[model samples]
Target: MGKITEFSEFAEAVKIANELVAQSAVAISARKMGHRALTVHAKPSASFAPGPSQEKIAAALAPNASLLKEDPLPGPATPIHDAVLARPSRLATPAPKGSQAAKDGIYRGDKLANALYAMCQRGGFSGALIVDDNGLPLAVHQSPVPEEAIGAFAIVLGTALAKAGKLLGQHNAENISIDINYTEKIVLRRFMLGQSPGYLLVICPQEVDERGEVELSIEQIAQILKRA
Candidate 1:
């Protein structure tokens, strides 16, 4: 579903957030009211907590938020848990020099090798490479499938990431999530370049099992790229 632009008040946003944070037993009033923005926060911790930045945005809307007045977003010193979940994160390690690494070449065998290991545990599909946005290999763990097929899979995944960036309006696509199908697996992919450009994050699961696990793994790998 596309964005819902309803609900014109900060009170509405807060009301929805409170209900979600509580794990309310009923469909939220905001959902009933069809408040799109408010409904987004209907899940626990999904609401963007109000800190200075959020407070600033809220103040521009309603005078203030009750939750914000009492509590706030994680302070600067607060240790962030999942880096991916953070709205504004400056903690990622940089990938490399401005131009030391080729922007369009080199396979990321380091990361792919690990992903391959996990997929192999379940007799998963042939492994495909993860490549940067520019079609450079960031990593490659060979799938049990024919070696000749790997390049095409990588390229196809790479193309998907490039198109997705434009669709999402993000500088880089975020992560490779998993959505399983029994006989054949459905792989959700993402690409991000820390130093140069992002590469594909390929996922082949026995079946669609874990979304959170996939997200966490992608973030960990992305962090590695940031420092490389």
Candidate 2:
């Protein structure tokens, strides 16, 4: 009976750890994709006082910060997603050409097409794309985004996001969801797959209050990727 309690505790710990890995993956992906919404609310640099240097204060407090310490003891083995998230800096690094990990981490070809198609068919979303870490599309479903231009768009947007985060010192961003009020409302959501640096971009019309459905569908797609 005592052992059963221990087993339950262990199971609970594992579950929490998995959740952390998943969140970390999303954060890494968000950073890589250059999600701008995450930093939209950050206090402007111009607002800082012209007093003592912020750098000095940070340096003085550095030693006491937990993040400044050596890496913690190894946790559960990191899968591709966790590994990519573990090194937040990797998002800024150039992807190696011909590297198998980058190629294989998220299976290519229409692997994600069906899921994306289903999501788009649910209504509101105009299109969807499952993109790899490098912004190359693995699957594109009904997106007006031209197949030839997807990669370039991803790279440009990601670079912008990373630059903004760095300037604001908000290096960890989980995902980017933005609603643009144009002639027609447009919603854009960008999030990472749980097992890789891969990303999912969903673009939808803001009409008809379909935000909840869109969110649920994206989450369902993430779960499916985790099991894949």
Candidate 3:
């Protein structure tokens, strides 16, 4: 190749400079148009924060000054016996004086409690609880386990079992029996007391039935409460 002439070199350089200027003008025009489009087409938006809306919802749901005092919901530490003795508010209240339920010998108070204790002793039960359909204890007999705890467990577990039965098309589940064979066997029997929707809950060691004495004690308790 020969050495390029100065005129030819100057001509090539001028051509490149013109091309670059034209391209830069096009780029500047595109950027200006883009900026104009963004400014003109963009819409103002109203943003919402979750905090305010959530606060409003919570305030609306909270109890107001006019709201009345409500009864306690069914849950742990709700004091079952106290609620049972609170008032004659439950529909299954004791039979009126001289009425059929009264004549049938509806047991209550210390007499009923003593009877339950004796029944537990006779059956060698760890604990026993007689509760209404609402899971309120009418009578409880203590042993190694607290009667209140046994009653609560019975209501919750038995209710779950009954619901499970109903879901499987077995409505009005009459009994829920659980036997746990661990270091020591634990047996729990919950059955509907005859006639009423009340329940008779018996918790006893597996050994209690080794001699086959539990069945008789249960039968006696059932017979006694059937009149109630």
The local distance difference test score of each candidate is: 0.41, 0.46, 0.46
lDDT of 1 by residue, 163-215 (tens): 77788776466444333223333354564464554544443434434345455
C-alpha displacement of 201 in model 3, angstroms? 2.1
Residue-level lDDT of model 2, residues 39-118, one tens digit each, is 11111111111122334334323555332243221233321222212332101222357775256543323335556656
User: Of 1 and 2, which scores higher on TM-score?
Assistant: 2
Q: After superposition, how far is residue 15 of candidate 3 from its true place, in Å?
A: 99
| Clash pairs for candidate 3 | none
Among these predictions, the greatest TM-score belongs to 2
* TM-score for each of the candidates: 0.37, 0.42, 0.41
Arranged by TM-score with the best first, the candidates are 2, 3, 1
1 or 3, which is superior by lDDT? Answer: 3
- Candidates in descending lDDT order: 2, 3, 1
